[model samples]
Structure formats: structure tokens, C-alpha cells
Target: MSKRLSVETSSAAASSLFQQCTPFGMSIISAGFQRSAQLLEMSSLHPEKTREQILEQADQEWIPGTVFLVDVDRSLAVQHEGQSDIVLIPQPSKDPNDPLRWSQTKKNIQFAILFYWSFMTSVATNWNGPVWGIWVEIFETSYSVLNDTSAVCWCFLGLGCLFLQPTAMTLGRRCVYLFATLIQTLGNVMGGVAKNVGVLYGVNIMTGFAGAPCDSLVQISTTDIFFQHERATRISLLTFALYSGSYLGPIAAGYIVENNRFGWRWCYWFLVIFFGALLALQVVFMEDSTFVGQRENETEVEKEIIAQVISKEEGQVYVSASSEKDQNVTVFEEKDFAAPLDIPTQRTYMQRMGLIERKYNDKRPWWKIFIRPSLTLALPAIVWGGFVYGVQVMWLSLIATTQSEFFSVAPYNFSTAAVGDTNFSSLIGCFIGMFWGGPLSDKFVAWKARRNNGVMEPEFRLWFLILPAIINSGGLLMYGLGVNAGVHWILPAGFGMGCLGFGMGSGGAIVLTYALDCYPQLQSEGMVMILFLRNMIGMGFTFAIQPWLDTDGMVTTTWLMFMLSVVFNMSCLIFIMWGKKWRKMTKNLYLKFSDPHFFL
Candidate 1:
């Protein structure tokens, strides 16, 4: 077999000699092509796969840059009739220098570092919610000023959420993680020793920015490490970190605050030490998670097979490369084959690192991230979930203020510390909620998806939403009534603690899962939006909460809250029923369509 081919301008060749290449070479190319076609089909018919299958597939396939391709622009990128060219570029080796395929041990360590970073960030944001009274006393300020401080802290949380995507896109996930962790730790320490409210607010801003990367980086990292089906469970676990930190924070704060000698300062000091240690751990564990290349162990035939599978699944038009270069390749090989032109020139280690940094440089502004439908939908969920989660977080204050006057007098005669103890029930509720939300959500979504003819609809994710809505409303109402009648304090405490936490967690899961299902492509953007909305909602609720309770009393205010909750819960059902329609209609407007053209 003899053929002539240009190195760079090579075109697709259909000659018989080309098809009769060496057995080893042909086998590798064929495998890669088949794999690509399968991947494309899977991505295209998503939600078609059941939950178990999805997760199973993810566990099996989710390697870094597992579905990536290289552009061979000069050639006709196509497939013959009845032959699906799944593989985009058979043996399209990524620069081995790419960081995407770092050792598993290294990746796990980085993930752990990110997890701790998030834990500290969330802790710093809400840890102060429980100790507002202490702040009022220490600063010798009016309650209004204390309220402002609280609002300020939450607003910063909001700000962090809002900026997360833009920052990640602009600064790159690694830079954001590295700097944000350092800044947040420093902020916590600074806030711990600060005497003035002004200084405290400044430190709060620092902490807020510092915390931004926790969610953003974790999201990016999750994408890096896991495939689509595994995303929810892994993201769910990441959220578990947040909830655990949030729940433990107040417990730790209450105990520390109970010690008269330690007071609130110790709470800040405690957070500082915890986060500082976390910062140190992250420095070693976390690394850049980007699309680096695979090793040669991944054979050429395997690459082509995978790429072919991906192409069909994605419904992309596949055009075959021209035969001009194919002819040249045969002749060249018969004489003395040159190095495969597809293999890129290797870079020095420093040069490769520099290239990565250059890619990390800021490209898009922050607001650009929110313009897409995937981001738009996901952001709301994040915000709402965050809002609900935050409200539950400060449930202690809401309960204390609303029920305190009633509990302090007459039969109860409870001290401040005892009031805090009432919160133990809510903590238990949170645990129940967290445990139930995880597996139930995974199972329910899978089952419903099967019932719906194997198409995974976003509505399926809303099944759990119903439980939380009813529970949260009923719990709030019970707490109000218990306080109104001055019944045994246990009534309000148990209802608020147990039911409230359960409801919040259920709602959180639905919102998160839905957002993810709807906007897998723009997940980072979606997460950022959700984070922003949630923190802002929390801040608003916290500020208005005291006033609402003061004006309407616990019973009336709680009833009103119940009504509001009912409306949103019911809306979930409506959305679920018509969600696909809504999503389709809004796909261009407010919904982010998973790139039908995307390769897994």
C-alpha cells in the first residue's frame, strides 16, 4: 500500500489500504470510535437512563477528560451512511502535561481540602446568628445597630454567592480557592480580635469573599471528578458538609457562650482556629481541576470507539476526513513513518503551568454567567434553598425571640441557656432530614423517571418538595400555638426542632436536585445564582423577623408564614406537572438546555 499525505493539510481517505492497517492499530481505532458513539447517545437521551443506571454509569465512566476530543479542522469531520463516527479524533492525546488526569490520591486530597474550605466558610457566615445578644452587649450599641450587623454579615454571604461564578470564570477555580481560603481564615482571625463594629464588618467582607470559592470550586471539582449521574449524590454529600457545619456551629457557640468567662469572643477564636487548620490542609490537597490530557495507556482504538458513541448520542453531523492525507500516510508508513502529527509538541513543565495560568486569566464578567437559562433556573433554587436553609439556621433566634417572653414567665421560668437547649430538637430534625433526603431523593427520582417512560423530568425531583412544605408549615404553626397558649415548652421546642429541620432539608434537596437536572451544562453559574439568592433571602428574613414578631405576635406571624409556605409548596406541584412544558417554553428565555450537542 502506497499513498502520499500532507502533514497538516491531511484529508479523509476511504482507500481499502487505509482500512487494512495493522491489526493492533486498527483494533485501537475501532474501539475508540465505538466508545465515542455510545457516549454521544447516552448524553443525548439523558434522564432516559434510570437513577441506578445513571449512577452506575457515572461510577464507571467518570474519569478526567473522559469524553474530550481534539479538533481536526482541515479534515471533513464526518461518517459514512450506516456508520456512526462516534470518535471525534481517534487517539487524540491531550498534552500529558494537562492536570486533569492527576493521580486519584492527589484528586481526593484536593477534594477534601475544598470540603474543609466550604465548611469553614459556611460556619463563619452563620456562627454569629446565635450570639446577636452578646454582640449588643459587647459593643454597647442599640439593638438596631446589632440588627444592621446581622444584616451586613448575611449580605456579604449574598455578595459572595453573586460573585462566585464570575470570579471563578475570571480568576479560575484554583486561584479563587487558594486566595479565598487564605482571606477567609484571616478574616475570621481578624474578626475574633476586633473591638470595633467597623473592623468587624470589614472582616466580614473578607470572610464573605473567602467563602465564595467553597461552593464554586466544589461544584467545578465535582464536575471534574464525577460524571453526570454521580453528580447529585456527590453534590449532596458536599451539602452535607455545609449542613453539618451549620448545625454544629450553634451547638458549639451556645456551649461556649454559656461559659461566662469565654463569652462570644471565644466563639470567633474557635472558628478561627478551625478554619486556619483547614486552610493549611487545603494548601496541600487542592489543585487545579481542568481538562488535561490522558495517558497512552488509553489506546487509540478505544478513543475512536468512545468518540463515535458520543457523536451519535449528541446528534451532531459527523463528516469523515478526506482521503488525500490518508493516501500519503500509507506511503510514508511503507518507507519510514514519521511521528503522528496529531501528537502536539511537548512543553517544559514551567511552560505548561504558565499555559494553564494564562487560561485562568479573567475572560468574562460576573453578570454574564447569569444570562443563561441553566444558570437562571439554578440560581433561584440555590437562593431559595439557601434562604430556607438559613432560616432554619437562625431558627434558634426566631424561636427565642418569639417564644421567650412567654417561656420566661410563669410555669416555664426558663433561663437563656435553657432557651438555647430548646434548639436541640431542631438539630435532631436536621439530622433526620439530611439522612432521609439523600437516599430517598435518589430513589424517588429514579423510580419516577422510570414511570415517566425513562425520561428524567425535572418534575420528578419535586416529589420530596411536598413533604417539606407540609411539615415546615405545620411545625411553624405548632410552635406559634404552643407559645400562644403557654403550653409546656417542650411542645414548641420539639415541633420547631424536629419538624422544622426535616422540612427545610427536604425542600433543600428538591431545589438543589431540580436546578442540577435542569442546568447540567452551566452548573457553576446555576450554583452561584442559587447561592446569591439564598443568602440574600436569609438576610432579609433575619432583618424583618424581629420586627414581624414584634408587630404581629408569634401566632399571627407564624400563621402568615404558614400561608406563604403553602403557596410555594403548592407551586412546586404545579411546576412539576407542567415543568417540562415550562422548561421547553423557557428553554431559550429562562431555561438552560443541556447542550443537546454536548458530548459527555
Candidate 2:
């Protein structure tokens, strides 16, 4: 097709051409439709005299995540990124308002908001770690008591998604993100003035409730603005933001606690200040990424037909009228064709900044969306993802719960500032790990896809995960064992913490990317289920940590954690081996969940 849809054609001729075009589903989730095997059988112009005519000819068929990425034949019509053969997945539509067609400057601004939000959410939750000792003294409570409050907070964090995500789906990402920030701001005010454990409990619970989006909503927002190919790198950067805040928060908290003038309470105040500023930036600049396109009124079959005809017209794929006699033929004769002219228009700035850009024909009630996570939990892939990510959280929670107790009393006799400074090691490790897992992994998968004749399997990325599994196990041993052995502070504080942070950074990012890839249509619900289970698991581990350490001591507990990390992380092998098989088995279930519109 001609690059410009402005080239008009006769209505009757366009109708006849569309009728002959094969059926393919439009995701309604993207500007460019995501092509897959789910395409329906359709009538063709070619006749079936002795045998059926196959208009489409290919050396190999494509699958989900698989596309003519290299465009080796270079016959595909859509615009390629730069001069590269890489075809944009979920091809961008002509609509200038489409999120997929957004300018780089616009995308960066959107991404910055999400990245900062995730970063601050993590920081707010973890900054309290360094101050736990001081709080314990001031509140006349034990470390175990404070840890229990945190366990409850984890529960709130997980459960918070049940309410917030559906509202995001019903309302729009803009409002939910802003509300989350507001809640966090108020919770910090509560925390800054907590005079007793009861008040801190409220603070912890409120923070947990507000912080839920860190695990799920930010992910949904990321996917809204990025394509499948660009997702890994972007998610990795956001993952880095999450961990940077997590590890860095304690460092800041430690310094604050050590300084009498500013004090630990300033930690809460600082969050109030920065996140308040973030909320303001968002109020002014955050535009809703949701794009309601032309297919809103079309039936499934019609939508698919409209979508595929458009794809064929765009030249992403082609059909050849070949039978057994000419089966060896591989030729694609491109012809100029026009795309549908009716497209969504760009919204006014006021409309763009509106708190709710409700989906067109998005009639599902909030309760229907609320219950989606339960159904999603049945998926084996999401369950496994939860366990992997949850284990990573368990390690972080363990550090928060034990950092002061372990470092403050002992041969090392570290002060609050020293304990805080230890976070620098994890921060360094997270940066490196995110590089390896995020960007390197993205390159690795694309390479694999090219080698597989431009076919990409979500599982291609899982192979890289094996390294993280091994790294995570080693880190657990180093941290727990080194701490118990009372080796040099560097042994446990630096190497152990560094490795743990590396695993946390790398493993969490890869697993999240894999899950979303497997079920792009269900990103929100899948994430809701995954984060819920992950936090619950983190909560259970948190509740158990004090007792487990008390009963088993650091040595046995270290071994236990070591085994847990190795086993859960290596579970990726199961998915790596049978993940595709499992996906195939659950295909019907997946379709039912994705419904008329996929998340893309």
C-alpha cells in the first residue's frame, strides 16, 4: 500500500477487496494491529477447481511474538524503524493521536512520570528500614513487633491492587496514578508524626495500600506507551528505578537517623515533599495514554477482517494464489492500497489531561474488572511468575527486617549510617543486573528470533533467566552465612547484599517481561494476580522471618533461604521447558479472559 492513506479508492472496489482479504483480529489495544495465528479462514478471489487455493505463501508460518522482523524479503508495507528490517509490532496506525505513534519527547515525558512514581513508591516503603531501630526504642517496642506491622503492610500493598487497578481500567491511568500519589503523601504525613506503634501501624498500612501500584499499575502504564519490542528495555529501566529507590532509601534513612537535627522523621517528610511535587508535575503534564480507535463498534469477525485487510493493504503480509503445482512459488507483488481513513482525532489539551478518558464501549462494570485477578490466578505461568518475583521480595523484606539487628550488634558493630551505606552495594549491583537482564536480554531474544527465521517465542527470553537463578542462590548464602559467620563487614554487607540486589534486579525484571509477553492481552489482570500472590508470599515470609531466625538461627535460616531461592527461581525451567505447551493448553481460557479487546 502507499505509505499515505490519503490516496482514496472507489467504495465498491474497496468492499470487494476487503471481502477477499483474510480475517485477522484487531487488538483495539494498539494503533497498529497485532498479527497472530488466530486469524480466521476467509474467502479468496482464487477458485478451488480440483483443490483449494492458498493465497498466502510462506517458508514458515508466524506465531505470537513471531513476525517478519528482519523483513528479509522486504516486501512488508509498514514503516520499519530507521533503515532496519525490524517491522514495528502492533503496527502504528495513521492516527497522529495513537500512543504507538507518539513523538519521542511525548513518550519520554510519560515514561518519566511512571518511572518516578514506581521509584517513589519503593522508596516510601523501604526508607523506614533504617529507622526501625530508633522507632523500636522510641515506641517501646521490639524489632519483631515492628516487623509484624510491616507484614501487615505487605498484605495491604498486595490487596490494594484489587481496588486500584479496576478503577484505572474504568477511570483511566491518569486519575489512579494521581490518587496513589496523594494517598502516599498523606500516609507520609501520618508517618512523620507517629507517636506510638498504633500510629505507625496505620502509617504502614496506609503506605502499603498506596504503594500497591508499584508492583502492577506502573507496569500497565509502561505497556500502554511502548511496543512489544521496546518493552524489555523500558521495563528494565523502570525496574532499575524500583530497586534504586529500594536500596537507596535505606541509605538516606540511615543518614537521617544518624543526624540529630534532620532525624529519621525527616525521611517521611522528604517523601512528602518529593512525591507531592511529582503529583503536581503529573497534574499538569500527564496525559491519558488510553487510545480508543475505530474498531469499537465492530464485531469480532468484522474487526478481524477490517484489521487483516488493513494489514494486507499495508503490506505487512501477502497472499499468493498457489496450489500443489506451484507450491514452490515465493513471490509477493506489492500494490498500492489505501488504509481506512476514519481514525481517532487528537484530543484537546484539557481533554487529554482529564482525570478519566473512559474506554469507548468499555461497558464492563468495575466489579467485573475487580474479579478478573481471581480468574487470572488459574494460569500456571502467572502463578510461577508470582513465586519468582515473590521470592525476590522475600529477600528484600529479609534485609529490611534484619539489617539493623544483624549489623548493630556484633563483631562488626556497624552504626546506622554504615548500615545505610551498605545500600550503595545493592544499588551498584542493581544497575549492573538491570543492564544484563533488561537491555542485554532484549538483544538476546531479538537475536534468537532472527536466527529462528524471524520467529520470536516468549520462552526465548527465559534462557537468560537461568543465570539469575544461580546468582540469586549464591547471594542468599553469602548474606545469611556471611552475617552469621561474623566475617569482615565487606563479606556480608558488600558481596552478599550486592549479589542479592543483582538477583532481585535481574530476576524480577525478566520474569515480569516473560509473563506479560505470554499474555499481552491480560497484562493488568495477570499483574494483579502476580503482585497479589507475590506480596502475600512476601507477607508470609515477613511474618515468619523473625520466628524463623529466632528458632533456626542465621545459619539454618540462610540455608533455607538459599534452598527457597534456588528452587523457586529454577522453576523457570518448568515454564522454559513446557511454557509453550502450557500456553497452548490454556489458549481457550486465555481467549475467554482477553475477550473482545486485548491489552496489546
Candidate 3:
């Protein structure tokens, strides 16, 4: 009778262990217990392990809630509780109190720093302005060589644009930030010491490449941090930095170059120092904010408390949703493999080919970024915005070189430094534009959106484009005729600055804001595209301007600019009037190829 009791007691202990291990049904408990026991038997039979060790390994591998286990000899028990049935996982909240969600005052501090950084970069880019005349005298070359060099400068920016996204993907945003600024600062330092045009060009390439990511990263950073409502205001403030730098370059460069002791190289020395300060500040204050995927390593106590806080049904729903997302989609997979559906990926053919051995969304068909209807409307706007931006930026440097010299000789007899002061007018125009255009745009956009029953169409932003159009054309006309007809130079200078300020202010704000509003998710990719076009055109036109003036004279070149300005500005209005209908007709065209979620 005592022997029979011992057998029954052993059977009862085994049954209890089986029930504890299985999460679902009674049959599952029996099956799981049998499997665990058989695994232990197999482990004991192996040459490496004793029976005791086998039983320990089996216990660890067959932990509750574990679906599968491998490397049995090395397996460790995971402390999981509750049934293996679905349960909710907690997610991180988007904290409104984070720096991204800071008040207007705090946010402006960041914007101001960024604006200053942009200003310094622009100054570095355009510092060649006052000295171009010196180059002409030294090289004894036609404007073609100068033009070609300018073309090279802009082309370098395009090359930078092409690679920035790819680099950002691999190296991450902070690494790019640190390296670009460092290289740019070094480039400026080199420029101060450069002896030849070739050296200067090489330095410009470095600075431009370093600065290329600035426009892309600043806008992206803003998007990452700010909500949709605040982006326009922040963008307007930053745009001022971009346009002001061009006008401000000559102010500092002219003053420095005018001093017999300092000379043109002094301008670059200033940039080196300026960027050095910014780099230091960024390193000290900037923190990484990439949202990390939630960890499932919560302790038993934390899990219990959270479970009590959230209902079981809600928890289950959250887990189900979380499991469906590719929160940690590996870079290799994105570049190489196809999704399970056999759908092709959206990367360029070269990108796919480069990672042929790896896999993710690789097999998807290639899709053009600009072909979507929303982006199609956006493309022209981007081109026009870039044209306006490039034209003004180049104009200041060009005038300081070609026109300033003309004004400084014989009858005019203004000093080179005096010629540099002409940029002050443009700078003043930029300030006025920033002041006038920024707030008015915000007001107009909000009001228009409200008037349209809060539907929030992108076209509402274009209404602000018209005034800047007239101002830009009018300013070009004034500046042109003032030079050609030789009116009291101030008349044309003031008009030129006013019109430029007007155009730059309105043009920069609206184009950027419109782009952001239209494609909130793809803001970074779209911004890079905008910079690509704008810089390309700006570079092309800078070289083209002097030749055009030399070949056709100031009057013809100015008039041509005026015509282009009017035609493009008018095209913006046409799109604004009909763009909503077009967007409705072709929704998610980009979705057929690229995952819109990646951008979001």
C-alpha cells in the first residue's frame, strides 16, 4: 500500500508541472509535457551531457510562453508569466514636453542657432563675390571661365544632394551632422590659406558638400521635432537665414577686403571661426531623438502593474498592431530583398543592384519621385522656388563682381569697399522681406484654410506667391535699367533690394511651407529634391548671368529674367486653382511603388 502511494504522488507532481507549462488547453499541456520529457531524454543520451544537466537544459528551453528554442545546451530560462495567449505590449508616447514640443521661446533658440549656422554657410559660399573682380584681373580670362567655375560649384551641390540620403541611411543623422560640420569648417580654413583658383575650387567643393546636408537636415530636424501647425513659422524664420546670408556676405567681405591688412582671405578666416563655434555648440547641446523601438524586457512586477492599468482587450489590440509593424526593418532588407507578396521595391536600380545579395523590398518596380500628381504640382513649384532663390543669391555676388567695378571707375569712382556696400541694400531687402512675408504668409494661409472650411488644400499657400512675383520682376527691371541707363545708382539699388527682399521673403516661405503641408511624411526627401534643383539652377544662372550680360547686355538679361519670373509665377497660380482636383484624381500614385509609411 505504501509503494502504491509513492507512485501516485510522483504522477501528481508531473501533472502539476505539465499544467503550469501549457497556456491553452488540457490536451496542449499533455502534449507539451511529453515533448519536454522526450527532449530531456535525447539530451541525456548525447555524449556531452549527464542526465541531471539534460533535465536542467530541458527545463530552461521549455519556459512558459516560449514558442521555440534553439541551442539547447546553451539555453537559459526566460522569466515570462501569464498564458501564451495574446496580450498587449506598451508603446512609448510622443511627449509634448520634449524639446520638439517646447514652447515658442525655446524652439526659437534652436531656430536662431540653425539660422546663424545657415548664415555662416551662405557667407562662405558667396564670399567670392567681392573678389571675383580681382580674379578677372588676375586670370585675364573671359567671363566664361568664371562662369564655368560657378557651374562647378553648383554641380557639386547636386552631387552632394544625390549622396546625402544614402549616407544618412547608413551612418545615421548625428554622424552626418558631426562630420559635415567638421569638414566644412576645415574647408573654410583651407580657403583662407588657398593660393590658386584650383585650390579655391577644391575648398568650395568641400564646403558645399558639408553645407549641402545643412538645408536637408535642418528642415528634417524641424519636421522631426515640430508638429504640422508650427513648421511654417519655423521654416520662415530659417528661410531668413538662407536668403540673408547672401546679402550679408558682401557686407562683411567688403569691409574685410577693403582693409589693406585683411584682404579677401579674411572673409574665409571669419567663416572658419564662425563654423568652429557652431560645431562646438552642436556637439555640446544636440542630442539624438530617433524614436527607439519599445523593448519587451519588462520585469514581472512592471508587467503586472501595467496589466492592471490597461484592460486585457486593449492590451491585446495594441500587441496585435505592434506585431504588424516593421519597426526595426533592417537596412539590408530595405535595400535588397522583396516583400513576401513578390512586390518590387522602390529604390533606384543602382541601389538594388549594389545590394543584390541582401533582401527586403528589393524586387519592387522603380518609381519616379516626381511623377505623382501631388508631387507633379509640387515639382514646378520647387523649380520656380529654386529659380527665384538661386537668382537672388547669385545676383548679389554677381553685382559685387561685374556691376560694382563698372560703378567704381572714372565717372562713378566708388571704392571697391563702397561697391561691396551695394549688398547692404539687398540685405536690407531681405530683412524687410522676412519681417513682412513671414507673418503675412502665416496669417494668409490660416485664413484661407479657414475660408475653405478647413479642408487644408496646398493651393491656398500659392496666393501669397503673386505679390513676390511682381516685386521680383520689378526689382530686376529697376536694377537692370539703373545699370544700363546709368541713373543715380541709389534709385536702382533701393528698388532692386526692395524687390529682391519681397521676392525672397515670400518665395522662400510659401514654397517651403506648401511642400511641407502637401507631403508631410516625405518632407526630407522632398526637401532634398528642392535643394537639388535650386542649387543646380543657381549655379547655372550664376555663370550664365555674366555671359548673358556680356553677350546681350544688362537690359536683355534682366528682361529675360523678368519674363521667366512672370511665366513661372503665373504657372503657380494655375496649379493652385486646379491642384486639389488633380490630387483627388490621382491619390496614392507614389504608393503603387514606394511605401508611404517609410516617409511617414
Model 1 regions more than 4 Å off: 1-108, 196-199, 214-217, 290-356, 359-420, 450-453, 589-600
Report the lDDT of model 3 for residue 557. 77
Q: How does each model score on lDDT? A: 0.56, 0.76, 0.58
Tens digit of per-residue lDDT, candidate 1, span 241-338: 66556656655676787887887788878877786676565554455555422422222232333343344454543321221223111011111323
User: Runs in model 2 with CA error above 4 Å?
Assistant: 1-70, 77-79, 292-341, 359-361, 596-600
What are the TM-scores, per candidate, against the unseen true structure?
0.67, 0.83, 0.67
- What does candidate 3's lDDT look like per residue over 49-96, in tens digits? 333443344333321111111112211122211222111112112232
Candidate 3 stretches greater than 4 Å from native: 1-99, 102-106, 138-143, 289-403, 593-600
User: TM-score: which is higher, 1 or 2?
Assistant: 2
Candidate 2 yields a Cα-based lDDT of 0.76
Please list all clashing residue pairs in model 3, or write none if there are none: 88-315, 333-360, 336-359, 337-359, 337-360, 337-362, 344-363, 344-364, 345-363, 345-364
Candidate 2 TM-score versus the reference = 0.83
